[model samples]
Target: MEVHPANEFYLQTREIATGNVVGCAGALEVVPVSQVRLPPAPVLDVHAYLADVPYTTSKEARRAVTSSQNGIRGDAGVDISDHGLTLDDEFPDEFEEGLVQEIYRRLTRTSVSDIPGPEPESLVLGNLRQFFQCQAGEIDFKWQELYGDVVRFKGPFGEDRLLVSDPKALQHIYQTSRYDFAKQAERREVSRLISGRGVLWAHGHDHQRQRKIMNPAFGPRETKAFAPLFSDVASKLGGKWKDFISQSPNQESVIDMTKWIGPATLDAMGIAAFDYEFGTLDNSDNELGNVFANMCVEVFGSLSAKDILRQALAGYLPKAIFRYIGDNAPNHRLEQLRKASAVATKVAKELIDGKVEALEVGKGKSDVMSLLVQANVSEDESTRMSEEEMIAQMRTFLLAGYETTATSLCWALLEIARHQDVQTKLRHEIHRKEREIRERGDRGLSASDFDTMPYLTAVIKESLRFHPASPSTYRETMKEDVLPLLKPITTLSGKVITELPVPKGLKVVTSINGYNRHKDVFGSDSHVYDPERWLVPGRIEKTAYVGVYGNLLSFAGGVR
Candidate 1:
């Protein structure tokens, strides 16, 4: 149960490093948890102590306001007079009477309103405009500032939703009572069109089963084994770029990274996942690759009118009816996705058949597909994934395996390119590591090598923090619960509340962006992109339920 800060969030219990699997061949030696050292907790700033100002007077009252000028324009400012409440309904004379009578009067008359939150515009086509207006990701910070960590709002689907950014509340929902909340129904229904019932879409025991079967393939030991494959593919891409530049008379070529990374990642995925070669980087024409690439652009690239309409309809329409509409409609994107799914399925089936045949001939390779098929045909019927389930997983892998990793890699490279000092330091560290490897006669970078590189780890962590692939996601509560807050908030009625009561059907959308750069947690300089923050002791806050990776919600938490 050793956990290194660099890979803690990325590696799950399912991905155990020590295992008797095909790719692994045998158990790898485990690093003791006690031997893994993390940076010390960040020290608190002097100004941090000023966070506890009482709201007993108007001057001392706190409000989260977003203003363009020095002055706020509206008359709707929070009233602090008498703690912003009216006691007109209270029986003044009776309030001073017997204790029992006064208590009864107060209980019957007093009301506690919901917590204040950001106001969205009228449902012009069902909050579509509001959703689009929040393109800059600052809305989360604004809302958290104005209304405390947990704020209530009318969601895009015309339901009361809570957008929570508090770490304690996040821990409560994600870790303590994970089963009490399920994936947002609308999103899950739509996702099934692409992912089917893969582990990404499974819940409870079903999810656990899928993870168990697939764990060996994703374990740290197996992932480290794929390092050479990654390096070889990457080196080939570098060579391609060099040739392209040489072809240009100016000794420089404009390479569209958007176009380039996809193919390179596609090749990487093909080799690493199934030992199949797409050769996309070599400019080989791959039908499945084209379909997969196009489908990604159509679904996850941007939000068009068609996408917005389809998403809005998903909230109301039944999955079957909506799918029928998608199938029959004149939407080009929808049609492409359907074709893509068909192609992906056909390819997955062929690959699995090949692996099975290889196994029969006693020539099985140690790729993910072979190991998965091996696990499938074994005696453990309950843990084995059916053919359909395996295909669904294949689809998930194709989409998730390449796109997000490529995006993160791009961001990391961009950041390194922009910061010369950071780049120089990283290069020096790389040289040092190379020297050590050469001296030790190590063939390639190992898991231990990755663990020891602090600068490289910091760069990757900073990139992930700066730009999480999924900025926000929704969850619907299935059971009533109370969320504890790290910071207490004063309500409009002047009453201080430490816990919030969440209804069974309440919708919660967590802001990963906001939490990553939380001022209170990460200090006032949280918004800045400084990799040095990771080196500085006490710069990052300790959070109870901060996702899977090093207190970052980038990869999300819970079973995911």
Candidate 2:
């Protein structure tokens, strides 16, 4: 139930204290609904903000640009790396950023009638509602269909934003040039608030360093080793459900699967990732569970105007202003966000030292957390991760891994229910596979065993396509670049272009669902949930280097 405040998903802390500060667990800080006001983006003075900072060298210039965001020395000073997005890294570092911002302002303020998109509902709100549909839920596929693969929609305060699903463009954006486009500054700031400077928060070299060390523990080999742990969690969940049914006098009850599924995934992540048991499945750990559930309800459950404005401001406002709102703002959503994170932070701290010690003594469990601990203790001192960074990764995995897995599983189950034939077919395949394994004298599925069943794999892939956990990823251009398109389209001004020229600071939305269901890629029946599509050879068109699996953008390429 814990919602990630990353893009309406993650919230990183400022002045993070390593020491535990105990509060009333799951306590609600009630604030009047009317007290919440739409925060205006700060119109900061360029010269005044930059005047006092030292900028003699290239490094100092970049530092000043990052540090001066606070109208003082800003601390969250990570920069988007020049990794995949083929950004021009040759520019002089010792340059005035104020002039750059002013130029960007003029360009953004100028007319952009070249790109085609739907009209906005309001000048102030822009196409935010349409964007929200794509991000939160109720994806507006009609826009892509009408405006072609690339649509230039309005962002907050009527700034131009691009919604793109073209294959070549996606390749350029996600793979060919990943570092050029990073999770928008606001998204990173929010993630930092929630998890500190973990992999999710770290980008560029920091991200590469963190991912390199932890990648071993998340690979196929490690996953196969933990299959038994997953089986145990599933068995526990099934027993709990059985008890629920038995307690009913009618012996049948309409149970909310979400209520159970959320906690089940939490327990799974706890054991698999950290080797810690949250006991949320049976409702024993209500402190963390209730707090997270309340946060999910408050943030994701409804489209409150207040919460919407908070998220919208993140999209348009400067990082300094956005972080200010995140840290100092008064709202029910933030209260629950802080509370849930506080409780989780307490748990992560409790687990960190033991994980380190266990690994040091060579008695550590081969869980991902332990691997990270081992990595931290690596002989290469320069590459080792700090305990704080380790803690951030733990929190990152929980927020990113747990709810997302449960939600996807629930979606898979829902899809199965919707199509009875698929359910029956999937069940038959699973039974046959299990029987085959048992006949070989094996008791249950290993992670490798599951891979051998083609149909089950298809069903899972289909579910991922149909209900991608992350519907879309928000990105910002660090520099001006041309996005090449696989399919060309005419602009509003009647110019046919194969490549799109995006200016600096342009906000682009890489549409996962749009690409997943694109007619050219997935065929005319892309919108349909047909697992048989995978069964039929050549039914799906493969786009090179887009997603981590099945040519889908679910595992979004380019975290930076």
Please tell me which predicted candidate would have the highest lDDT against the true structure: 2
TM-score of each: 0.76, 0.77
Q: Candidate 2: where are CA atoms >4 Å away?
A: 1-112, 133-139, 301-306, 315-318, 377-382, 558-560
Instruction: Specify the poorest-scoring 10-residue window by lDDT in model 1.
Output: 53-62
Backbone clash count, each prediction separately: 7, 22
Residue 217, candidate 2: how far off, in angstroms?
0.6
CA-RMSD of model 2: 16.8
Q: Which clashing pairs does model 1 show? A: 9-548, 9-549, 41-538, 42-538, 42-539, 43-538, 64-146
lDDT of 2 by residue, 1-560 (tens): 22211111111111212221111112112232233222222343434422211122234543643453323122222221211111123544424344434422322221234678888878777877656644443444888878888888886667778888898898888887858888888878878777778987887888888877877777877878788888888988999889989999889988887778888888888888888888998775567666665355465555554455567777767778877877778866666666666777777877887886777677887777787777776789656988888888877777667767878999998998899999898889889987898899987778887778898899999999988987888888898787888887776656576776666778888888888888888889888999999989889888656887888888787554
Question: What clash count does candidate 1 reach?
Answer: 7
Question: Model 1's lDDT to the true fold?
Answer: 0.67
Clashes of 2: 22
Tens-digit per-residue lDDT, 282-357, candidate 1: 7647776677664665665557655666665576777687767766777676677677767878888998998899
